[model samples]
Target: MTVSGKTRHRFRCRYTSMPSPTSSLSSSYRNPGGSVSSSSLYHHASYLRRGKLVLGIMDFKWTLVFVITLLNLQPSSANGNGTVERKVHVGFIVDTQSWMGKIVDSCISMALSDLYLRNNHYRTKLVVHTRDFHGDPFLVLSQALSLLQSVELDALIVAESSGGVKILAGLGSRVKIPIISLFAAAPSLSFSQHPYWIRIGEDESSQAKGIATIVEEFRWRSVIFIYEDNDSAREFLPDLITSFEETDTRIALHIALLTSSTDGDIIDQLKKLMDLHTSVYVVHTSPILASRLFLNAKWLGMIGKEYAWITTSMITNFVNSMDPSVIEAMQGVVRFKPYVPSSKAVRRFEIRWSKNIDGNQNLQEIELNVCMVYGPMI
Candidate 1:
């Protein structure tokens, strides 16, 4: 009852070396059957008056426990117990630094947001983990492997023309999950061969027919054909040839340029076509390369009233957003793309998409296969 500061210090030192301190805190200082309040962060002074001595310990330090709870105590991956929605993990690998990849990424995000907004009561959600390759096909393969190793993916999505479609599809087959391919124009994929691989778009056969039909309508006997020189492009040539043969239009000249062709390289190619008797030119390649070809053609005065320039859907989809000067360079150039109906939803998507990509002018409406973006979540 008369303990001084020195006496309190001695008692404190004696209690400091105990094997278990809970015993003294519960039994020696508290009420007869009362134990320490382990959950409460602080104890009231009234607890001491009633001889309860409610000692508050740091019971909130359960990071490991919370993690275990999230892993073991949560609901299944598909169904929730009326508390939280279950997650269906998805993996997306793309060249995000590229213009096309960035647009695809935006479309994927819009699809996911629209999906959950319409189905807020849905029990499952798709959680996407994205890896960017920045145009390197090898990086795409590595990223696919990394995602497969790190996540229990419900599905994995890749750009079909990204050059690793076969390897990624093989990975999906081994894991027994679906591999969704977007913008599939490479002509190498066969649905029958790879059961796990799902292609959202077709190769260039339909587009080729559309181009040939234009040639027939104009009564052009033959026209020059230009395409990117790559394995995929080479494989695509037979389709164009067959389509042109049907319309009795001959491919007078076929020129191939590397994907990395420069302004000088493109202008040189155009000059050759300009000197030719046939004035019609059908150019098919990736968007970037197509831009260079047409712009160079404009510079060489090959895109004027005398010459006819046509392009595939790949370039048309993003043509409206190209620098106005580039679009002007493409003046009188004809292109065929999947017709997208103008809806309020589509208009809003275009506006928001332009803002996201920081477009200087409005982008022309085009088709992105919604089925591919939405299927992974299901």
Candidate 2:
């Protein structure tokens, strides 16, 4: 399922071969039009027997030249600042299972295809992987490393949810290439040991600090933290609670331990918190769990005036497919502000990107920002 090595490895695997169109034409040229040309038919039979279409050195060289030329036509580059030109064959290791991964992958693809690469300048390829960690971060890290090893790349783009980040941080030293984390929340990955790793999304520490600011602004005396008791919550909840200590906030931790996170479990948790006089109720959970909370809250008629719920930015995808009334009702009540994009610049790029991709504007702002920034630089 995965391609390995610079050269194609021959195996005892079933495969088919086809003759070159040029050779087929050449043999036909030597004979008059008939039921079949003898030379052409012989070459075709030979190709089928070989079970592989092997291109000559000249074709390989031409392909390399074309790819190089395509990679060179970027809108921005290190050379723009009069710096020495250092080209890169960037590889993106994306998780196709997650919503954010798909967004980042599409953006990278659109940026490469529509940017200078299409014009024959900068060379880039996106290597899509899957997030099948099942709450284990190590699985994600291993998959990324394995896929990365298969590609010839100068940089790697890793897009993962929480569990994925843990795996990547653990495997930080082993991954020699520059790895940029896209839409990740793990803060530990930003440590000095992994200098090549850059956080493309808001780090957990930054997000926790941001929430602390909100808590202070509202002058909430007592805070209640409810998390979907999973590995991510286990890893982050303590750090998040501790982050509030810097602001002199007292946090009452509430755990809704769910094996499968059913609607009943969510409502049951809300019932317990309903009587608590906490002003801010911080939800340390996924958007799937967030949607459950919102739905249960709405059904119980406690969404509007009772308690204000705050969660992570993961709810953006869930918000899109939510009930319109639920979405509107949860706006101020359940808020998670993302990094604000400058409207003017974003609009301009949206128009241009839409035109290039040949469709309507349908990309996340962060992903679009990556495209805008790197499109010119690649």
Give the winner by TM-score.
1
Return the top candidate by lDDT.
1
Model 1 lDDT tens row, 1-378: 000121101000011112242232221222223332312101221121221111111122242243234334334543335565666677888777765676677778876777778878766566889988778777878898899889877777786475577677777778887777665535555656667776554435655655665556456788888889866667667878987888778999889999888899888888777778887777778877887777777777675546667776566666655666776677556655544345686677766665555642332333342322322222
lDDT of 2 by residue, 1-378 (tens): 011112221111100112344332211211112323323433333333222212111133443464456445433335555654435555555555544544555566665555555555323333333334333455666666666677545555565555665556545557665565555445454457666555544334444555555555445666777776666566667667766887767786566556487877777877877777664677666656676676777687665433456665445434554556655546444334333335796676667655554542333222343323322222
Position 66, candidate 1: lDDT: 32
Candidate 1 vs. true structure, TM-score:
0.71
All candidates: TM-score:
0.71, 0.62
Predictions in order: lDDT: 0.59, 0.50
Residue 312 lDDT, candidate 2, scale 0-100: 55
